[model samples]
Target: MQQEFLPQMSSATAFIDLSGLVNLFDFETKAAQAMSNLAYEYVVSGAADELTLRWNRQALDNLKLNQTVLTDVTKPDTRVTLFGHELLYPILIAPTAYHGIMHPEAELATARGASAASATYVVSSFTTTPLEKIADTATQPLWFQLYVRDDREFTKDLVQKAQALGFQALCVTVDTPVGGVRNREQRINFGLPADVVAPYMLAPGPQKNPLTWKDIEWLQSLVDIPVLVKGIMNPNDAELAIQAGVSGVIVSNHGGRNLDTVPATIEVLPYIAERINGRVPVLMDGGIRRGTDVVKAIALGAKAVLIGKPICYGLACAGAPGVARVLTILREELELAMILLGKASVPAIDRSVLWEKPDN
Candidate 1:
């Protein structure tokens, strides 16, 4: 329990109210040093040109909100339903790997945070904790993220196992046919820490099969659960995902870790949303730091936005309590934004609330 953020923290806390444990930032900054170069890099790595990674934040800066005044928004219902499950809020914990490296608590802690925030947790395929156990720990619904595995049999087995354990959906990450070109993590020669090896990695590397629309079909065949393609940047691919009967598509560039000199996700989302045209839900993840960013993403046609990094940063600082604190900030910030904008329900948000910045 830590409560030193004060005044700014006080106003911020008022949004949804979580204090006494507000120093998740400071804790992560210190935790970064404790981690070996490899562990640190693996978690924090970004790509070449690093421009896309940075732009995730910068592009969000270009958009302006058309705040409505004097509307009756006394109670905003943040509840949203996606992939067949109704969530308390639209926020989902983006799949990040090997939480144990950052803290002993690992994914278990994250599950606790998402549960606390009433947000969904998307567990990474390469998780340090066993997936089933993480699912058991979750108080809220859990989704699974799949890396392209080299073994089709193994992939099928993984999906079956996830469903057996009650995961609600599968998010297949496609941006990394190969892992992202994380220059920072590279500089550190990021590798698994001795104490933090992923048990699943012992199985074998990902199947070298070239993923395509065909793979999506195969994936749908493997399970009854909803399938979401997680790395779509191109509208054509978005269309294909819709045709393949995916329940949703997430617009991500592996958090800008895979490509260099690419446009930020925010730069690509609106067009992708238009192409999909509501056939399948379109979700965005990458550079989302503010509640206003969530609003911007929703108006640009995101069904919901995924959050990464910040929760990990919070975890590095204080474990489950830290992550819960971070989510509190985001939720509060969003609630405040919704209230101020004179909106009362998540569905009420749409393109009308945003004005696009001309690409400079």
Candidate 2:
């Protein structure tokens, strides 16, 4: 019933195989080429030390989902619900801005794929399309990803706008207080608009101050939607997020873009999950290249998982269809894993299926 293009089982498609046919293309590399062709570099490169970014992917791949035996796997399922909203699959797209840099259709196409696939769309604060227009096109729910505006009033206004537009939740991206130190951008002297660009809130300048919990509280007070803290990795940070009255926590190291040499998101999920004690749902992103990776993440206690670079990769090659293709592979692969593992539903997966890494 789902429409897609899985490139024929040749050199390209064979690389990813059914194990991960959709992600066989390199959206990140293809995108870099497009950006370099378009003279856009500041937004994609990682900050100095770049080690953390590389590790996020490696750490995830290194984690093996210890497969289990013949329980009644006659009918497996992969549906998940988070923040009181149901997601057809546990994988959701991680918010990335400036989609126009990668595809002509950009965010509009992304919204279409996410909508069609029944996955949650976390609209970026710096999205190319206006929030209302994107929300208007959605066949599914929306989550507004917030980047604090110049002042409390301006930030409040953006939150109000998202709420009025019917975005179901607000995910506050906190790790990027100051933009990452991208030496590549410095080498080329690339920079964003010298002034403000957030169309939703006509605030001024590159925001100089970082938002604190007090500011987070202010945001929570202004909107009725549940607030989620994104870009957190450490368990200590997770504890603080719970106390802040936030509804969820997305454990991330900014896909290794923000801090260099931090723990891979996968390496940290268990500790964070243990700390939260299910008080709030824990979601994670970074280096999720396989369906088994999704299985490992939820089994380790991620309420759901998000994909960064991968969707962008698909966009570079095929626009909306590319993103849809990526999600399709992940969804099908997740279902197959569930079927093989005897899980009729996603929530039934747990630690019993995981094997402790000899290395970990």
Candidate 3:
């Protein structure tokens, strides 16, 4: 199957310009044409068997929405304030590694695009560009995603650099103790370029003592900015993050790239949100492609939704403009969803908008 796709890509030369694309799926199709086979799979594929990958979409599709009529929504507001920064919408660009694979501009283009859309960009630790450059280039809010190195001093230096550069928050990725078994990458023997490095990393792979709850506490102590722990799935873990002094929790399964067969981020979302019980903001990623998905997430108690693949697809298709278009489409979709559902503002969304599908 992979071989067939590669051959088809040989005739995929004429790039699909932004004007020709209408949705994320369209962008993804065009991107597949634009990128090399290995690069495309690395950005898009999930873990072994990809069951959780399929389930992430299935869970969102399984849920139903309850609409209200006869309520005034003359001016529906999609604005949100996250960690003291106000965003035009609740959609954030998820921190995916190696944007350079998709476009020449890489993280710089993404930062510019996100800033153009008035959205937040969570710059990945495994970035192709330097951290300070992205921070300096970004006009919108920037948050640094930390993958602590084996050396404690190196980790502290990275944290302090982010703080010094005016990064608003620290997003500690907690799931990747060791890299997951990405079967697609294995099949293609995918590896990073020799030039791409973490810049601050003192070692090659995951650190020896992969962060614990104590590490979370220690991370918080190192910086004055809000710290959000990403890669949480279980309610117990979410509770533990709060106890560890995290400012927020991102309920993700590493975009279905880690520990296959775990419940979809959407499947575990409400549970984690319920357990957190308003103690802190709960954001989620994985299988979020539509604006309605954003609305459903907020109704289920997500303060916002982080998007990964769509951003990749957008970059692949038309570079920075493609990414900005992706955000525009989703934002429009969310605002429309809100207005149609009689939600006047982000604060008006709640579980009341959700309908449980009847047991068969």
Candidate 4:
């Protein structure tokens, strides 16, 4: 009773005219028009009532920026360094599943686009393309997003494989023990097309086990590469992850796809960052649509921010070029935001950039 999602165009003819797309939302608008109903729903849908999904953007919108005047802002720097790798901008591509559903080149196209924009690309564990192939295509620093399986050996082997593949970091996702109740996808009976399968999943029997801090500790023991724990929203959990020896923490709510009614990642980011107290780097995702959002995240405490749906939308519109253009737009927007705020560098952003209402 499941419906399979497939795009109409072949990879060779997948290119769409991206001339009119000016921003991320423009890509979203175009992507919705270009993609099949099932594919678009899969990209945009969140869990249950989707309150958290809506709040992600709403909470960011509620935050007001306080700009300064009469400061020399001739040069604006958007560079950020994470785990020793310097990114041209603070924006990174969040790991998302089933890129093949959006475009024919799949993760290869995403990798090329991220590399073209000089941004870090995180490959999802549920990637349609093989990790080795993605690594081969990516010119920028690559990080592998891990969803630990019930089988400990399988999880261990996957970690080793990613390390061997030259992935710079292992981003272990710890939030999704079970799938979310996404009504939209459920309404469509969404299922992947036959040709699009996660190559790493071919070996594991089935992942039934939820990840634990102990598992994260074990993962750290396996390889010398830095292991980051993604899906952290609670401050206590962020503290625990650092104690467990994680190199970094990514504050996320699974893009509001895993749990409904949870606070937006942006809302909880400051608490997590405060708890970490600069002991380790903090990154966040969800509800980042503009350069101001990136600046807001940096000001609050995020070392960098990852974007999910926008990248998929870009891929759906015009393959690699669309993806690159999305990143470029965000970078330029962030640069402009920084210049207007009279902040010359990424590190110059702080709580002072935020406006607080006066008490009566």
Clashes of each: 5, 1, 0, 0
Lowest lDDT block of 10, candidate 1: 1-10
Model 3's lDDT to the true fold? Answer: 0.84
Worst 10 residues of 2 by lDDT: 8-17
- Candidate 4 regions with alpha-carbon error over 4 angstroms: 1-15, 202-208
Off by over 4 Å in 3: 1-16, 194-198, 201-206, 357-360
Better of 1 and 4 by TM-score: 4
Give the deviation of candidate 4 from the true structure as CA RMSD: 5.6
Question: Cα deviation of 259 in candidate 1 (Å)?
Answer: 0.8
- Using TM-score, give the best candidate's number: 4
For each candidate, what is the lDDT? 0.79, 0.76, 0.84, 0.88
Best by lDDT: 4
Q: What ranges in model 1 sit over 4 Å off?
A: 1-37, 202-207, 356-360
- On a 0 to 100 scale, what is the lDDT of residue 275 in model 4? 98
Q: How well is each residue in 1-360 modelled by candidate 3, as lDDT tens digits?
A: 001001111122235446677767788888898888877999889999898988998898887888889888867888898877788889999999888777777888788778777789998888888988998888888898998767788889889999899889999999988878888998999877665554554445666776789988999999999999999998999988988889999999998898899998888889999999999999999999888899888888899999999998887776667778888888877877888789999989988888767699
lDDT per residue (tens digit) for residues 1-360 in model 2? 234443223232233323333354455555465444333454446668788877877887776666667776765767787767777789988888767666666677788777767778888887877887888877778888888856767678788999999999999988877667677767886534433243553443456666788777878999999999998888888888888889999998887777788888889999999999999889999888778788888888998999867777776655665667778878877787777767778899897667775785
Better of 3 and 4 by TM-score: 4
Please list all clashing residue pairs in model 2, or write none if there are none: 27-313
Ranking by TM-score: 4, 3, 1, 2
